[model samples]
Target: MPAPQMMGIYPSDSISEVAHSLPIDPLGPGAADLLAGDVEYRLHLILQEAKKFMIHGKRATLLPEDVEYAMEALNVEPVLVPPRPLPIPSFQPVSVSSTSSSSHQAQQVYHTPDDEIDFAAYLKQPLPAGIASSAGVKWKAHWLAVEGVQPAIPENPAPGTSRAGPSRPQPASTSLRPQARAQLPQELQLYFTRLTTALVPPTPSAPETEPERHRLAALVSLRTDVAVAGILIYVIKWLSESIQKCLMAPTGTIGQLVDAVDAVLENEGLFVEPYMHQLLPPLLSIILTVPLGPHPPSSSSSSQPSPYDVRQRAAEVLGKIAEQYGKSYPGLIPRLVSTLTKALQSPPFPSPLGAAHPPAGRYEGAVLGLAALGSQAVKSGVWGKAGEGLSKIDELAGRLYIDGGKRKNPLIRATIKALSPLITAKPADVQAPQINMNEVTNAFGPYIANGLVKKGWTANELLRLRKEEMEEGEGGGEGMDMDTPRI
Candidate 1:
């Protein structure tokens, strides 16, 4: 069996592509009314459904068409359209001086104000809430639109209403208000009853209306992929927004906005767009310093973040960004050093008269980022910054070994590593402690004279040496070194 004929075939992962349509309404009562979001949830559903489809030797690619089929199978409302045609105006002109104008005009021309959108009610909608938080569900509608499954069409909708057609909220069977009952004309009742029945989605007829049945005899695939696709889409969008701000903003607005990048950085998601680690520090630096006006603390009670916390958080995000997409980032050394130094300061001194503030973090990563830059720059053909980069190693070493508590641990080892690449480093010459006279004389003066005599030095030379030693010994011998080896 020649390899089971698995030739010239390829599979594509479309989770990121159809990710825009990740939100779907899962089954249950009142699900229609509940806002449907949770794209991550939807993706899991799609994966499960896709797995079943795979066993039958189907194409692995989850195309938009496949997603559409999956949505239908799952009984999800991925698309909505205008339920009825709009009241078209025939363009008939009317005279302003018509006889029955005042009361009649008010009745005809005035429109009711939109019922205030119940933000609470909207948020309570299951799907919308999740989309807002994680971001994938909101884009699902667009995904469907792109796939030719149009948006919900509205009937004769209220004026000033956003007419994403046909998707009007029919009063739920469980509306808050009590139902009013009255006898209606038989024809009207029949028409309404039929419409309601059509509107009410029944449990999907499985293994028949579903695509799986067309291909296989007994397999029934239930794929509710909308949620995950939507979530991924939302995240993509969120990342898009983040990337735009990170890359395009004149200066970052990390802390300036009410809902800023702090949420994203602190949140639990990494595979974001333009995912460069170097961007993180710079991004945060922009936030902390830039923007036209300083972002005052939220309240007196809100404590300012310690320099260490802020710097660490930024560093952590950068580390992950680098780990995930370091390939895309250029100028990592300069960018990292630039940002880390910013982290170590409270912004630059504005002027001679500017108000002073405390120092930023001890510039913890400056040494590391610059050190890494020294070697990395050489490899990347960015050797121009190497000279300046080597300076960081010396600076860090000086701080560690001479200034900052004279630490002698991993920090010193790291300093050494950082300094190893520099051509300018020399072993530091520290002054020796005071020495005993006995040690000095025994090691240098008389011992040298004795050794010289034993080596057959003339008596004249010995007498000269003894007289010189006596003269040198008269003083404190601060600069004496009469024990020069002669033999």
Candidate 2:
């Protein structure tokens, strides 16, 4: 079969002329045509490569560098063409002015002292670059004259109104309050994808089989980078919203998320410490109120992990975080106490779309959240304050025990266990433990005082050794007459 013809992008006539332009060459009959065909093929390849370069650079216009880069990538030497100087346009001076003005006026045409009519030279002169006239080009119909006292157009907008012409349409409000997640920026979307994947892999099959790869990676990220921690907070917020809007429970991802949070609490890194104040609210919400996972089918037996289990896990995670970081963030305890008290007191959610009170698991979660804060939270009458000395937590726990001691209610039992230490002893009898200042100072030695004075190097003996080493180094020399004692 005859070879299929190749379509040429460059004009054959131009290529042929360039081929013939070589001084010593007399044209062979098909040589010019062959060269033209080759040139066309090369040009087509260059254009294709240049298009790819343009796309990679995210530019619509194909620049000279794009072609050069394409040539370099393809191992083709490119012809360098020097840029020609721009032709300077000349201008003839024309005098223009208002003829109606009776006062003496300066000449309308401005000129340098040389008086030659050279627009380029005039432009090159060290003078301000601007239109000679005071007026700007008007693109739309503007009221040149406004109400008598209102500032004229372009200088200032009319009083109380801002348009020179009809105003542009206002964008539709994209308020995401009741329904959807807020639209994240493109960069944030990418970060969210990477972070969520790092938190909980897409196809997590078993919790115990692997070494929690994504969870470890996320903790490492939190330990080092504040920005990563912020991204995790963003993810947590988004997760809360997702749980709120979800029609049914999600898969076991919620448990994985709780595990990831627990890992962060366990890693006592600098970055995660300061962000606890911001981190606690969403975490408490997850424990006290947010849905954990998809509800089991009604036909399924009670053997399936109940919704309360997820809340309990979230509650445990909260307790761990509070036990670890709550001292640093004092406000966290009070907020948790308030939230738990409210949840415990509030009625169950009436329906899917009603004023949100709390869920069945919320009561349990509230107790757990309080327990996470330790005994002080319960002793403070977080549930309520009846009188000057009456303990509300004691009163509530007593009532629950009386109501269901034999029933073996887990939530009530947990609450009772948490509050038991605080309530068992009267406040008057439980005196604050006394500390011997001299004993503490003697046990810690001068190290504590030295650290406070010096701002570092807490171990006094180590500091003394370091100082002696430094002093010895100062006395030693590379070359010395050791035996000769001369003054």
Candidate 3:
């Protein structure tokens, strides 16, 4: 058996107050002290045992139920109260008034006081139907918005200002427009702030890892969380740089990052539509420049496979964005065309390996970007026949393909591929000549002779002579004499 534990004695005054409240006469002087001591001793024992229950349950905090169970184990009898019997009654009719006939109240009755309840029979009665034993709750899921735009639904409708409708009459003193933009929700703001910190590398040395990627995936799944959509601009720029550095990274991971960015841009309802101006520059820079990572190498090296891979990815995303939001964002197409053309014309970094390789590689990326941009570039006069720029672009593409005989170069290959679509000819639709040259020349000969007649000859006479000459020439089917008429 374990030795009993002792604890500090409780205040006697508190004990006396509890005793007086319990329908007991106030204890006299030292009697209160004795009662308090006994009660404290018992309480200390219960608590000592209750701690063992807490430990057994692997919990740090002690609860009331633990003390109750401990008391039971210690064989301490609980305070008992006998259950009161329910009353039953005998009914007697009461007087009713005719004027109260329409009242929903039931007719009055009198009950006799001597009746008693049949407790056993009441216990045996079945519970009423449709009454639940416990409360139940169900959860449902939905999207409130996509990007930063609120969607119209039963729970969250578009705001009154976003909708176009007739305004209700208001006092002339009041302005119709809302005064200021509403503040964002605290939780959503915190979520995106953390997400941006995690997803965007504050330092150049931060390594791309699985945990960060998973956080991004979770955020991406919340596409309808419009509050986070505006932060995508920063996220996208970071991803554009990430893909540039990790061109050789595992396709699956990098591809997911690409998909996430694309998904945000593609979301139809997001009101962050104006951010497209900011969104595309990073991607365009990546597509047009070589070695676009934060600390890109200044010199050309064999280690880099030129700019083909990163440019290919950026070009694809550029094409999709142009196709999707072309009309909504008119400037995107023009900017893409101009950037690509300018990059193609940019001077290469002078390198020991070869000065031409760097510029040629950049040109290749630009061409690939243009190819991905497709007919838009052509329509925008990027490669169209109208401008000096178009001719220069053609000449540049031609020189890179032919004069730069390094067939193994990615720049050369991409340039060839880009120009292929534009220069490739479909078979011309051949048709026979509509009119013969010989017949037309013969008919015009007489008119030529009449106009060239000497000054002495009358206009009428010259015309008559030319007509006679033509009739003679037509009948004979011979060629005109060159010495007879200069015409």
The RMSD (Cα, Å) of candidate 3 is 30.0
In terms of TM-score, the best-performing candidate is: 2
Using all chains and alpha carbons, the TM-scores for the candidates as numbered come to: 0.24, 0.38, 0.37
- Off-target runs (Cα >4 Å) in candidate 2 are 1-195, 201-204, 207-248, 273-278, 290-292, 296-305, 320-329, 347-359, 381-405, 423-487
In lDDT terms, how accurate is model 2?
0.53
Model 3 worst lDDT run, 10 consecutive residues? 168-177
Query: lDDT, candidate 1, residue 346?
Result: 27
Give residue 315's error in model 1 in angstroms: 1.6
Model 3 agreement with the true structure over 1-487: per-residue lDDT tens digits = 4333333468777877788789877676577667667888889899999999999999999997898889899998777555786555567777555557578565665765455889778656665554434446233467887897777777786587455653321111111112211344456455645654443333222236765565566546445566556445444455555555443333333334455556666555565466665557656665655433312242423333334665677678778878877788787778878877777666555543453533455676677788788755743434333223334543454444434332234553454345344432423574322333233224322222222233112223323334565577675654455434766
What is the overall TM-score of model 1 with all chains considered together?
0.24
Per-residue alpha-carbon lDDT of candidate 2 for residues 231-337, written as tens digits (9 for 90 to 100) = 55564554444434321334345565566566656544434565565556656666665344443343432333555666677778777777766687778667777
Task: Write the candidate numbers in order of decreasing TM-score.
Answer: 2, 3, 1
lDDT ranking of the models: 3, 2, 1
Model 3 regions more than 4 Å off: 1-184, 197-209, 212-219, 222-260, 294-306, 329-331, 346-357, 376-408, 419-487
Q: What is the lDDT of candidate 3?
A: 0.54
Per-residue lDDT over 1-487 for candidate 1, one digit per residue giving the tens place of the 0 to 100 score? 2222222212112333343466743334422222133444576687666555554457766555665566777887676567898866454343343356454442223333445898778766677555567844452222234365445545333435566543422212311112211344444344333322222223222335643233222111101112222233233333334433432221112221212233333334333454333335454452233221122323421343333333344444555444444456555545655654444332333322242432222334443343444544222221123133223332433433323332333323333344445323333573333334343234333222222232222223323343555666665353444433431
Instruction: List lDDT for all candidates, in order.
Output: 0.37, 0.53, 0.54
Runs of candidate 1 with Cα error greater than 4 angstroms are 1-304, 328-348, 351-353, 357-487
